[model samples]
Target: MNSYMKHGFAVAALSAACNAAFAADDITVIKIGSAAPTTGAIANLGKENENGARLAVEDVNRRGLVINGKKIKLELDAVDDQADPRQGTQVAQRLVDDGVVAVVGHLNSGVSIAASRIYHDAQILQISPDSTNPKFTQQGFNTTYRLVATDAQQSPVLAHYALETLKAKKVAIVDDSTAYGQGLADQFSSAVKSGGATVVAREATNDKTIDFKGVITKIKGQSPDVIFYGGMDATAGPFIKQVAQLGLNAKVLGGDGTCSDEVIALAGPAVDRLVCSIAGLPLSRMKAGPAFEKEYQQRFGMPVQIYAPYAYDAVMVIVDAMKKSGSTDHAKILAAASATDYQGLTGQIQFDDKGDVRSPRLTLYGYKDGKKTLLTTMTP
Candidate 1:
């Protein structure tokens, strides 16, 4: 009796050890990094991008991803860049140093452009969900990918819409002087002049400024049919409010930075005269939009401002690439990303040779009755 009991106990101990070893070998953790301004003036947009990445991580984990015969658990490493280039580069290095397999952040084009060099040096895949300055993808860095349309495409579409649809014969322009703001304004100004519209005035400001009285007063003298502002919702909202205060009747135009629900809160009644362009189709138009919006609201307890869906897609794109390659190695992910053909909430996402979305579309929007209303969708 004693010998038999001892043998049974020995066999059970061996089985338990083997089971623990198998369980340990069957799971792998994949960390993905994201950076955006979650505390600054445009933090709403940054938060949107972050939430997207977070949602993607959660969603991927829920589905129980299996890669190379091992169960994969995705982790999101998120940081705030304050939409500043210096902080962006810092966050980029932090993510790289932390050994993230991929990154999905830096909402501002300026931040994305600055931080991209760090990601490139580390050979990590960096996908920006909203940065649209055009220069971010032109730097010959195969590690960089953007899920949205660039300003090179958006500004022209917006300018032509202003001329043809809005009939803005005389346009005034203001830029916040940041990389994203200035670059987009430059593109829009060029397109406006080319479209046979008159640019009566041009002005510049900083990202942190709250008052735009000087520029508004100067622009008002010109009696512009439309006043184009190239900046985020923070400055753009207050500037639109000032325009209304001073009795300027010109329609305010901007890029995706100002095409958000935050503008309604920032401008109040002045939002009625605001028109902006986003880098993709309106959320309501996407086949997956309703479901995503529902899930996002349930998880985050707030509505998406902008770029959340794109950010989610960016993370998913990286995960999809990792799956295709059956590895989380940066180089393999980058190669797989170069050939991405996934249809996401933002539509088909396929990168061009320069790492920009292929045939990216721009969506024009206007605020009416304190809500964002889609005006039209255009491509260039």
Candidate 2:
């Protein structure tokens, strides 16, 4: 090559390298943590939550995030808590140490409650998409927020439905003994008594108990009009299947945890007997749910489980806070989050004094033709 041509090529390469370096230096990276049980029986649900957060991050970057006149890049640091309390705390600490300014996860109420203190101590904003237990927000942690209604609001609705709609004169209650399950059962029990329904039996089983023949056998003897199982689909599926196998002809009721597609997969034909309530509006009812659902399916190659839309909204809320605050400072962003009033894919996003969604909606679902069909949506 000629010397002039070589010189020109060298200048062009140097200019391109400089521009690349400048572009890299101009962007600020912000890390957001997403924690859930990505392994074990409920991994599908956890993965759904994580995928929501990931999609939000991608969307934000695509739209060109800018804060304080500086370009910002968002990153998702997802961790697995295995739906265990101890692991949840460990994951919380890791996220804090990893320099995440905010988190949008820990799907289980037990896990969210267990890890809440760590996030509070670190002053990192923690927005849970599906933790429905009241204590999670009642702990008086300013840094903690949730995207769904609590069991306090949801159980009474289910109770009323059981008493008025289903006309259950006698009810049997079973819980998986996790905070989410037990809390929901306790609330439902109180509501049932208040609604003048006779509580025929109450049973306690841990979340990992798959073989519920003993419990089913005991429940079968009660001849209850309805059986309410407060737990996730993993156990609820088998429990309901066993209940049917043991010839317990009562209708099955469940909380949001059991109101998943996984339950339909696990329980098979028995799922038809299940009438479950979710702590939020059905996807068909959300303002932007249809578009989000379409995009989610295209991006993730799977349907939305219970909490993906909420998780997506949680991440967007965090980003909205960052934008409103005009800085990435954790304290500033948190302050902004406390005043959030954004329109999310789920619904109008606003937090009550206890960090719970204000005027939250609950959805009742029943299976029809082996598919989850919405019965009704109510505000409680």
lDDT of 2 by residue, 1-380 (tens): 99999999999999999999999999999999999999999999999999999999999999999999999999999999999999999999999999999999789999999999999998999999999999999898999899998999999988998999989999999999999999999999999999999999999999999999998888888899999999999999999889989998899999999999999889989899999999998788987888989999999899887889999999999999998999998888988998999999998899988898898999999998789998999989
Once fitted onto the true fold, the runs of candidate 2 whose alpha carbons sit more than 4 angstroms away are none
lDDT of each residue in 129-177, candidate 1, tens digit only: 9999989999999898998889989899889889989898999999999
Error of 2 at 113 (Å): 0.6
lDDT of 1: 0.90
TM-score of the candidate numbered 2?
A: 0.99
The residue pairs that clash in candidate 2, if any, are none
The most accurate candidate by lDDT is 2
Per-model CA lDDT versus the true structure: 0.90, 0.93
